[model samples]
Structure formats: C-alpha cells, structure tokens
Target: MTFAGFLGLALQTIKAPRDVARLLLSARLSSEALWTAFALVVVLNTLVFSATIALMPQDGFGLLGNPVAFMVVQAAALAGAVIAIASIGRAMGGKADLAQVAVLLIWLQSLRVLAQAALMIIGIASQPLAAGLALGVSVLGIWLSMNFIDEAHELGSLFKSAGVLILALMALAVGLSLLLSLLGVVPQGMNGYV
Candidate 1:
C-alpha cells in the first residue's frame, strides 16, 4: 500500500457515486493488490478490536473463546468480505482495475473498522446497536463524500444510495462469516482441526 494508493482511495471515496465506479473501472487493479490492501485494513482493524477486547475483559463466548483463535477467524472472515466486495464491484460492471478497486475498497472499509473500534471501546452491551449505527453513518459519510467531487450535489439521492449500500455490505459480511463458520474451515476456540 503506497501513500498514493491511500490518497487515491480517500479521494475516490470522497468523489461522486458515479465517479467512484468510474475510478474503479478505470484503474483496473489486480486481485493480489486488492486482496493485500483489504488484508492490511482488516489486520489493523482486528488489532484494535483485540486490544479493546483485552482491555474490557468480557465473559461470554468471547470470539471463539480464545484471542488468537478469534484473530484468525476474524482475519478469514475479513478476507471473505474482500472477496464478496470484489465480486460486487465486478458485478456492478467494474472493469477490473485492481489498484483503483483496492483503493476504493480500503477507503470505504476503513470507516467500518474505525466505527467498530469506537463501538468496542463503548463496551459489548452497546456494541451491536452502536455498530449498526456506525455502519449506516459511515456508509452515508462515504456516499456524501463522493458527492462532493462535483459542484451539483444531490444530497438526498446520495444518502439514500449510501443507506442501501451499507445494508447490503453488512448483510454480505454477516453471511460470509456464517458460511465460513458452518464450513468447519474456521478453527473453533484454541483448538486446531485437521
């Protein structure tokens, strides 16, 4: 992840919705680059989450009942998320600019990580609600940020689209997590299977 890649993603996310697609299609980044950037963001976000969990001392299942196992599961879950997003991007007619898609993904997903981190610090009881709110707000923020690229901004339309996008992404993430868990590919607690 070069600085340019970071800035490009940030700038693209802040561009218009139509422009976001345009930028992604134009850049045509590779799958490797896209996955790498996604992994980096997930790892960073997971670290923050792990730290929060460590500090809070929760008693429930506690992310597979082991911190290391939890991190591995989270990492796998996030990778699946990246695959899902890339598939979505492609289905949306993105022409496969790996670098650009990577940037866009990083920018869009960073907000989610930040939101989750914030929710975690707030404690588990409020975490779910806070996470949902953050998810909505972050998506809206990204959408609104995109509209700023041009002079004629349609705030209402952008907000509505953002809401839809947020919900879709959230569903996709949850679905991927559950699917992985069910497949028995993801390790349970501290025990290894194989």
Candidate 2:
C-alpha cells in the first residue's frame, strides 16, 4: 500500500477500529500466512523498539538493552497474547478463530511500529511532545485492541471485549512473570512483576 493509503488506514484504525477490524478479517488469510505476517510484524516492531532504545540515553533498562533478547521476549509475549485472546474470547462466546485474532493483532502491531517510528522522530524535536504522543498512542492502542477483539469475535459489545482483554493481559502478565523469574531474567533495579 502507498504511504497515504497506510496513513488513511491508520487514521481509520483509530477513528473506526471496528470497521478496520472487519476489513482485516474479511481478507480470509490462511493460518500460515497470518502466522508468517505475525512473525514479520513482531520482528519489525522489535527493530523499531531496539532502534529507539539504542538512540536514547542509557537508562537502567537492561532487558531492553539487548536487542536479541528483547526480540525473543517480544515474540513470546505477542504469541502468548494471541493465544490468550483467542482462547479467552472463545470461552466468552466470541466466534473469532485464532487466525482472525492473529490478523487483527498483527495489524495493530504493524501500526505500533509506525507509531514508534513517529515517536522517535518527534522525540528528536521535543521530548515532552514525544512523551505525550506516546501516552496517547498507548491509550489508543488499548482502545483499538478492545474494538478489534469485539469485531473479530463478533462479540457485539465493547464491555465483553474489554473483559477478554483484561483477562488475557492478566494471564499474560502472570505467565510471563513466572517464566521470566524461572529464567532469572529480572529487569535491573526492579522487583519481580507479579
């Protein structure tokens, strides 16, 4: 897609996320294709994240300091999120399959990469503005995810999708925290996330 087209879609994703979710779901992507795109999006996101971290002053964030490790963690986290959303949504009577969930998430992640790049550029001009943009983007990400889940699962209710998202995030946090602890990969200067 052209840059303008991408921007238009990005705007649509924020303005009418349910419709964007429907458009993505209607693509009828195969599981393999969805997974491959998911992987690619994860990698792209990692690259942007790593680059952003590299350019910033050395913070105490050791986990994000290692690109390879960060990439691995990112991939695992995203895959877990996909599974959690798909399963939890299904248990909640959502009709979306794993592939449908994957597509929406992958598209969201792709947009995240774009947002990250924009933040990086904006950070160069004004740190405060960049911080504000990051906060706004984070909020929008949550909102978009809720809408996407609702659309993908045909839940027809943002409240149900919000519940699924909350449960999925809680599960992910617990699971990742445990796995990270087991692997002795605690972030520097921070207690274990429980």
Candidate 3:
C-alpha cells in the first residue's frame, strides 16, 4: 500500500477500531496470513521501539543493553501474550476463536508501531510535543487494545476483557523474565533491567 493508504488505515484503526476489525475479519484471512502479519508487526514494533530507546539520550525504558537480544525477548513476550490471551480469554467464556484474537491483537500492535514511529520522528523535532503526544498515544493504545480484545473475543464487558488482558500481561512478563534469566543477560534499565 502507498504511504497515504497505510497512514489512512492507521488513522481508521484509531478512529473506528471496531469497524476496522470487522473489515479485517470479513476478509476471512487465512491462518498463515495471520501468523505472517503477527510476525511482521512484532518485528516492526521491535525495530521502532529499539530505535526510540536507543535515541533517547535518557533512561527509564527498562529495556536497556543488547538491542538485538532485547528485540528477541520482546518478540517472545509478544508471542506469549498472544497465546496467553487466547487461552485465558477462552477460559473466561470468550466466544471468539484464537485466530480472531490473534488477528485483532496483531493489527492493534501494527498501529502502535506506527504511532511509535511517528512519536520518534516528532520527538526529533520537538521534545515537548513528543512527550505530550507520547502519553496520549500510550493511553489510547491501552484503551483501544482493551476494547479490541472485548469485541474480538465476544466478551460481554470491558471489565471482563481487562481481567483477561491483565492476566495475559502477567503471564507474558513472567515468561520473559524466566527467558532472560535463562540467558543470564542483564542490562541497565530504569530500576535495574528486567
């Protein structure tokens, strides 16, 4: 897609995520395509986030040292999140299948990467503007992801979906921590790397 088309798609995701999800699901994307999209989104996010952290000139990201390794860990955490959310959501009586959950989560992640890229570019121009926009983007991302999980999983309420999301995030964190420990790799973070 052209850059404008891609930007339009990203804007649509922020403006009307439910409709975006509906259109994405209506396409009946195949399992392979879903996986491909998920991987691409993960890689793109890792690249953007790593670049942002590297360029920060300041600490607090909690993802310090070994950018390559950090990216790998992030990818693993992301995969863990997808699996955990699918399992937990189902256990909580979510009617949606794993594919639906994966697709929506992956799509939202792609949007986040786009937002991060924009934030980084804008940060280069104006630190104050970037800082304010960064906070807004982060909040909007969390809210949108929660809503996406609820809608995609057919969960009845935001609270139910939030519960699932929290559990999934906890699971992802533990899984990543364990993986990092196994590798015996530690770097400096905001409060001493994870």
lDDT of 3 by residue, 1-194 (tens): 68898789878888887788777767778999987987788778878877877787666444434566766786787778778988999999887777887778787777888888989999989999999999999889878878778887888798998999999989988898789867765555433643
Q: Which clashing pairs does model 3 show?
A: none
Candidate 1 deviant stretches above 4 angstroms: 1-32, 85-103, 116-194
| Per-residue accuracy of model 2 over 22-92 as CA lDDT, tens digit each | 89999998878887988888788888887887677657756656777777778878888999999999999
The segments of candidate 3 whose C-alpha lies over 4 angstroms from its true place after superposition are 59-64, 187-194
Model 2 reaches what TM-score against the true structure? Answer: 0.92
Candidate 2 RMSD to the correct structure: 2.3
lDDT of each: 0.55, 0.88, 0.80
Q: Give the TM-scores of the predictions, in the order they appear.
A: 0.50, 0.92, 0.85
Per-residue lDDT value at 86 in model 1: 47
Question: Which rank order by TM-score, best down to worst?
Answer: 2, 3, 1
Give model 1's TM-score versus the native structure.
0.50
Please write out the lDDT profile of model 1 over residues 1-194, one tens digit for every residue: 57688567556555544666455545666778667767777677767767776766665544454556665666665554445544544444333333443455565567557656667766566766866876787667655434421112222344543443454468676876676567454544545544
